[model samples]
Target: MANDFEVGVDVGVDPDAAWRLAGDPVAIRDWFGPVSDIAVDGDLRTVTMGNGAQLLERLVDRDDAARTYSYVVESGIPGLTSHRATIRVVEAPGGSRVLWRQTATSDVEGYDIEARLSGVMTAGLESLRDRLEGAAA
Candidate 1:
């Protein structure tokens, strides 16, 4: 079975500013803590985790005008069968809202995929808010 998760954060910056940072695949390492580094070659991105694990992802869709981008994990993570995620930035009253939604499936039983992914997404959004808000301040 697959698990779905969505997490978001409000930052004290305009949508354009937020999108500039979040929409860029290569900039993920700047705000995402677990990502130690990322290398992008065209529509494919290779992400290196802090623990030396690597994940390969392919960009499926992107709309700069809409401030949204999506990708699917082609490989990486033990037992993970499929994974897709989208990041979006939209205008909010204070500044902008950044949303991250993920759907994932794994072959491993009792793996608690939701807990793992949601925790990481929450922490990453917090980090993103801090970085963007701090920069705006």
Candidate 2:
């Protein structure tokens, strides 16, 4: 089965600031869940989670004009056949909104992969909002 979802977070920063922060994997490590270390080589990124889990991601598309970035997971997470994620920063009334979308296919027969992914996305977005807003304050 395939699962997809989007999590949006509004932060107290302009769209450009939000895009700048969201587009950098280094800044993502500061706010996105348990990411401990991030290393990038060209278009490939390796991320080490706080729990010592590691994942490889390939940058698929990035557009400054649209303020969007997309990537596909190459390996590391178990029980998933494939995973694709995208991040978009858009202007809002007061500040900006960061939208994270994830789509995945589970390798297992009956796993609640959607819920698991949703939890991670929610936590990451909340942390991102806090990080950006706190810095702006």
TM-score of each: 0.93, 0.92
**TM-score: model 2 vs. ground truth:** 0.92
What lDDT does the true structure give each of the candidates?
Answer: 0.90, 0.86
Clashes of each: 0, 0
* Candidate 1 C-alpha lDDT tens digits along 103-124: 8778888665678778888889
Q: TM-score of predicted model 1? A: 0.93
> In candidate 1, which residue pairs get closer than 3 Å at backbone N, Cα or C atoms, i.e. clash?
none
Q: Name the lDDT value of residue 54 in candidate 1.
A: 97
**For candidate 2, lDDT tens digit of each residue in 1-137?**
33787889888899998888898756788888778999999999999989999999998889989999899999998878988999999999889999999888876887665677778878888888888888889
